[model samples]
Each structure stands twice: as C-alpha cells, then as structure tokens.
Target: MVRRFGNGTATARAREEALGKLPSPRGRLPVIGHLHLLGSFPHVSLRDLAAQHGRDGLMLLRLGAVPTLVVSSPAAAQAVLRTHDHVFASRPHSPVTDILFYGSTDVAFCPYGHHWRQVKKIATTHLLTARKVRSYRHAREHEVRLVVAKLRRDAVGGDAVNMSDLLNAFANDVICHAVSGKSFRKQGHNKLFRELVEANSSLIGGFNLEDHFPALVKLDIIKRMVCAKARRVHKMWDDLLDSLIDHHASKPASERGGEDCDFIDVLLSVQQEYNLTKDHIKAQLTIMFEAGTDTSFIVLEYAMVRLMQSPHLMAKLQAEVRNTVPKEKDTVTEDDLTGLAYLKAVIKETLRLHMPAPLLVPHLSMAGCDVNGYTIPSETRVIVNSWALARDPSGWESAEEFVPERFLEGGSAAAVDYRGNDFLYLPFGAGRRICPGINFAIVTVEIMLANLMYHFDWKLPPRSGAGRWH
Candidate 1:
C-alpha cells in the first residue's frame, strides 16, 4: 500500500509549483547537501548556515534519497510550528520510537490525531496536572534528601562524583515515585527498572543509522540492540503496571474512588469509562515512565554542567536561594520556588541553551502544504530546529553567552515564554503537540534546583583547574 511518487509525475509537478511560492535557499551542497558542513554539532553549524543564508533559509538534506528539509530560523520555525501546524503535525516513523513507545502510543512521539489526543489528555488531566505534581512533594523532597546526602558524603573526602550519574539517579527516583508511587531505592526491588532506564537513555543519545535511512532500518546493526532493549523494557513495564492495577483493584472502592488518586487510579477510571483494554493501559504507562524519566534527567544534567561552567552565576543563584529559603526547612516547598526569580531564569536559560531534544521530534506532512513559498509534498518528513531557533541572534541577544539575566525584568531579551506561544523558545515544543508533562517537569526541576542551592555550597574538586568552575 506504500505509494511512490515520480519526479516527472503530477504529484512532483504540483510540489514543484508549490515550492516556487516559498523562500528559496541561499545555497546548497551537492548530493550530501549540507551534511559535510553540519558535522556532529549540527545546531551550531546550522546556525552559521542560517546566518549566511538568511532568516528563511531552506536546505535539502539528502538523508538517503529523501530530501529532508531543515528549517533554522524563528520565522521558519513559526511557519512549521504555528502557521502550518496541522499540515505537519504527524510524527516521522522511526524504528526506535515505534518499538519503545508501543508503536507511538505516547504523547511525545505519537502522530497528531485522535489517539495522540487521548493519550495527551490522560497525561495532562491525571498525571501532569499542577495538583497532581504538587501532591508528590514528599517524593521530590525524599529524593533530593538522598541526592544531597550522597553529595555531602562524597564532598567530605574531596571525591569527584560523576554528576551525570547522580543527576540521572535523582531524576529517575523522582519520576518513578511520581508515576508509580514508589522509588527505585525501595527494598526488594528488581533491577529491570534501572536497566530499562539506562537502555532508553542510551537509545535516545546513541547514534542510529535507521533514523535517517528508513530502507536500512532492518539491516542496521543498532536494530538488534534496540529490539533487545525494547523487549526488556516492555516486560518490565508490563509487570509493573499489572501489579499497580491489581493493587488498585484490590483496594476498597472507598479508597480507590477518592479525590486523592494516583496515575494508576486515574488510568483505571479511564479504562472503565472507555472500556479500554489492559494493553492500552500498559502502553500509556510505559510511555510516561520512559519519556518522563529520560527528558527530566537530560535537562537537569545540562543545567548542572552550565552552572559548573559559570561560578559567578552559581554563586548568585545560591545566594538568591539561601536568602529566599530558610535553613530550618528540611525541603524547599512549591511556594518557595515561586519567589525565586533567579532560579527560574537560570532554568530557562539552560533550556534555551541546550534543549534536550534539539530537533523537537520530527513531524511528517500528512498532506501537501506551502510554507514560506516552498511546496512540501504530502508525506514528506519535516524537522523543526528548535535548538537553532532558541539561539537565533534575531530572537535573542548574545545568543551564545550563558546569561540568565536575559530572562529577568528589563533585560534586552523579551519574554518569549515557553507556553506554546513563542516558537523561538519551544523547549517543550508547541501547538497541539506540545509536551503534556510540561507542568510536572517545571515543578520537579524548580523544587530540586532550589533545594540544592539552599542546602549546600558547590565547588570544583581539588587538583582540577579553577577553569572547571570558570
């Protein structure tokens, strides 16, 4: 049932005619397109390319025979994310996401449609609502206590902890507690959860030839690794959800029917109402666990790195947090987070600098559409470069510098915000496809950062150059 279009056919002709209306590319390389110049740091390379090509630069990347379009400016991003959102809302099918996300049942990777909408609604209403996120304050506090306790012990001996691992563990614990009402550190635990978390993170960050070349998807060596990991993760998720469902079902109706319901309780209610199967519930839980844990960890890691590199910024942040939060408090409360303006600015800056998913997950055009005078054929894959847009000089001042002040009052940079309105600052993405966990993520990150700053003073390990802390 797969249909192929010929260059000389009417479909191609119509596309060419549509292309005539859009902004033309300033330049393009041969068969490889801009691949050679892109190298590993595609974000920076694309930024430079856009500077030379102009705001509406369009380039054809020969990602195999398919000419994938990479849009690098705010205007172009708006065209893709805002003006033509519906036309390009469907996700590009990938072997990793397809298998890991239960054939794209999750909110982040699901193609735009009824199924995606249903999944997103459940996430927003039951899992990521502000009330739901705030209800897990004890979990967040407990995990932060563990993180700080461990860090303090390590710092006592002047030990250099691989912050990456610590942060990953912190995020994983918080997410697990939030989603399952349990922590990975619980006694009598299985190692499957940790294994699946590691594998999922690796798959996201690891290079996969299959993403760019669909024809070679089955032939690629990474496919085997992906399948193995997927099977393991699927099994673990199935077991975990089965237990949660059973536990809730066993609970008296009085306990389960209360207003204080967890994610599992919410899903069960939905299942009964919609007459959904256990498999559907499992698919939803799997997506939430994998996506929630990995993304929050990535952002936290990036924030820590940026703070380490900018000591003055760190000192200022710490001072602000200490001044705002009392030492007697065992944990920083959600209300405390609101008063810490600088902390919010720091997080916003980190996200602006390093959006975890730089490409914002590719979307396929369901139907032919015209954007900025270019004709996009129906079924053509489109990628929105949120990473590039965040740093576009046109949108931000000194875009490369680590200046959190840009988000403060009266700063040169305007408050574009991240609530799906500004395409330039879409770290959570935009339109109907925006991430559903945005509220939960913000609360978790803000609370953690505030507590860390309030509780301790951080410094680079001895013998390491001061340059490490900048």
Candidate 2:
C-alpha cells in the first residue's frame, strides 16, 4: 500500500510540474482561477493575453476546474493539431452536448474512439464525399438561381433585398436538399431549422457556466436547468428527424439508397450494417444540419460585406467571373468556375478573416503529450486560437487588410490553402478532426458568389452606404 501511494504521489507531482512549465498569467482567484480575466469576447481577450504572456504561442489558463491550453502560432498549431493530433483529437463532453446530441454521439461533438472513427467514415464515405457533393450540383445550381431571381425581382421595386435572409435561406435549402432531398423553406422547415441552430449555437458554440464549473453543474438544480433547456430543443429535433427518416425509409430499397439518396436514406441503408441506434442517426443528421446551414451563409454574407467595402477587389472579382463564363450564359454554372482564380481567392480570404468557429470546437487531449517542449497532461482542454494565427502580422502581409490577392499568384500566402496542409491559415481546422464538408461548403459558396458577380453590379443604397460595410 505504501509503495502504491508513493508512486501515485510522484505521478501527481510530475503532472503539476509539467503543467507549471507552460506560461500562464497571474491573478488566479481561489475557485474561478482565470475565469474573471476572460471577458465578453474570450477569443479576442485570449489573443491579447497570449501576445502579452504566451511563450512560443502557448498560454495556459485555469478556467474554473478545467486547465485550458490556448494555441496561437503556426508552429504551435502544427504541433498540437498535427504532430500530436491523435492525442488531442477528442472533444470535452460538456453538459450541452450530452443533452442535445443524445449523449454526444455526433461527429462534431462525439468523443474520439471507435465510435467517432466509424461515424466520420460514414459521413466521409457515404454523405460528404466529393462525388456525393457533385451529384447534388443541379440542386445547388437551382438554389443559386432562385436567389438571383429573388434579388432581381426585388430590384424592380427599388426596394432593398435582405441579403442576410436570402443568403441564409439559400444555405438552409441547399443543406436541406442534401440531407433530406427537400426544400426546407417551401416545406415550412426553414425557419424551424434556423431557430434550432440558433438555440444550439447559444449552448454549444461557446464556453458556458457548466463548462467552467463542471462540478457545480452536478448539483441537482443546475443539472435540471441545463438539461431541461437542451432536452426541449432535442425533442423538437427528434420529432422532425423522425419524420424525415421515416419518409425516406419507407421508400423501396432501389429508390432510396441507390445511386442517389439523401443523408437519411444513406444512414438508414447502413444502419443494420453499422449497428447504429436510432439516436445515432439523429445525432449525425443534427450536426450536419447545424454545421452545414451556418458555415456557408456566414461566408457569403461576409464576402459581400467585404466586397462592398472594397470596390477594387469587387471589380477585380467581377471581371474574372464575367470574363471567364461565356457571354451567352445567363447564370454561372459550376463548370464556369474553372480558372476563376480571383473568385476562389476572395472566398479563401473571407474564410481567413471570419471563420464561423473562431476558436474551433475545443479539442481534448486523450493522453499526456509534449507540445512546444512542454507536457500537456491528459484530458486538458485545448483551444487553437485560429483567428489569431490567420490574422497574425508576422506570417501575413498587410494582415489586417482584406486583400484576396495574397492568395493569387506571386503573393505571400500563395502557397497556403485551407485543407489542413498549411497550418498558418486553418479556416476549416486540421488533422483527424478537420471538417469533412469542405467541398460541399466551398462549392455552394462559389456558385452563389460567382453568379452574383456575373449577373449584377452591386451598389450600397443611398442611405445605407456610408460607414456601413465596415
């Protein structure tokens, strides 16, 4: 007994020594530690704090009971996301995820292990493959056409179109079609999905009280409060998902899971083979809906905002899109997107400046690992401040400016890409947990942006132009 106790004591001491080696700011309170230091915008605050106190772009903060590691530089990002990826591939299961994601079985929030690997495989192999996305080209093009038509119709009245709603609807419908082979808006599910996504975002997208004070949440009152809200949301999701899955499953085998099938059909077809539960299917579909619907719209909205602010860049992109597609064509097709370098560059630049998930879904270290010559103990919550890495002046020229040309030929970041290859600009993250829907999301944005440029000359309204795009 004495020997075992002595060994455990040595291990605990070593763990503390390892964590103590990393740079951390002072002012750790008795219970909350550094929670008070992080303000309204934790990402921005963390970025500034890291600049001041981080060593080799690594900063440690004791966020309540959790020990958090903030990664801010390219080298440090590579170390944590690539060299030690397997060790940090899992997620920290928060109360929100457990309640909403049906015990956290979805790809985005699922803990890494046999289940995650299998779920991700189903997503990549069956749902989000390049071929699968390509197969939906007609559906995507049709969605874009609807948007262009809506804008043109509104222009005749000289009334301003709500680009946010249009872009959001376009994104929502595209994902809905891909997931359930239905039009989300026409079927009256568009607003429902948006509401649920917003509700889920409020819970899952950031650090919550339960995340900081994990033990405190275990108390009956707090647990009931958190679980009640999430469960209410989950019940709505469950009802909708059941209807969609049932609609698809009732179809004949050949018609449902053959050459063309929605995500539900595919999931149902593979259910028996994969030994998946009904809850598992719903969880995967939910993340796909939430992540898919949100990413494309934000990129589209911000791209327009940035373009409206900079006329030159907008003109440059418009020229490329207009000149590349034949004059005979009324709308830009996916094929016309070929060799549209500036168009892709503009989208790439937008993602860099405004990734939907700035501090990407937190990665949990599964085992003790050495990063930047310091040991990160097992189960440490790791956050890669990707926003800082992408915007750091050290690695980017004119970093603060919205210059898409940097991604074109002969520019500084010309070699950089978002596909986990270059760590400097990780818009979609990297390594094992890199987003699998990149192709689906990018192509959807491209078709829409390309057509918007090809068909129209944008101008801010007389009243809304000044100081608005910024």
Q: What is residue 246's positional error in candidate 1, in angstroms?
A: 4.1
TM-score of each: 0.87, 0.95
Off by over 4 Å in 2: 1-10, 183-186, 462-470
* Per-residue lDDT over 1-470 for candidate 2, one digit per residue giving the tens place of the 0 to 100 score: 00111247787787677789999999999989999998777778899999999999999999998899999999999998899888889999788898888889999899999999999999999999999989889989988889888889989978777899889888988898888886355578877888888788887765678998899786999888766778899899999888878777778888885555788888998998888999999999999988898899999999998898788889999999888899999789999887999999999999998888888889998778778778888778999998898889999988878999899999888889999988889989999999999999999999999999999888666666534221
Candidate 1 structure quality by residue, lDDT tens digits, 236-337: 766766777787677786775544466777787788665557776767776676667767777787777778767899999999988888878877877788
Residue pairs with backbone overlap in model 2 = none
Model 1 vs. true fold: TM: 0.87
Cα lDDT for residue 154, candidate 2: 88
- Choose the strongest candidate by lDDT: 2
Query: Each candidate's root-mean-square deviation in Å?
Result: 4.1, 2.9
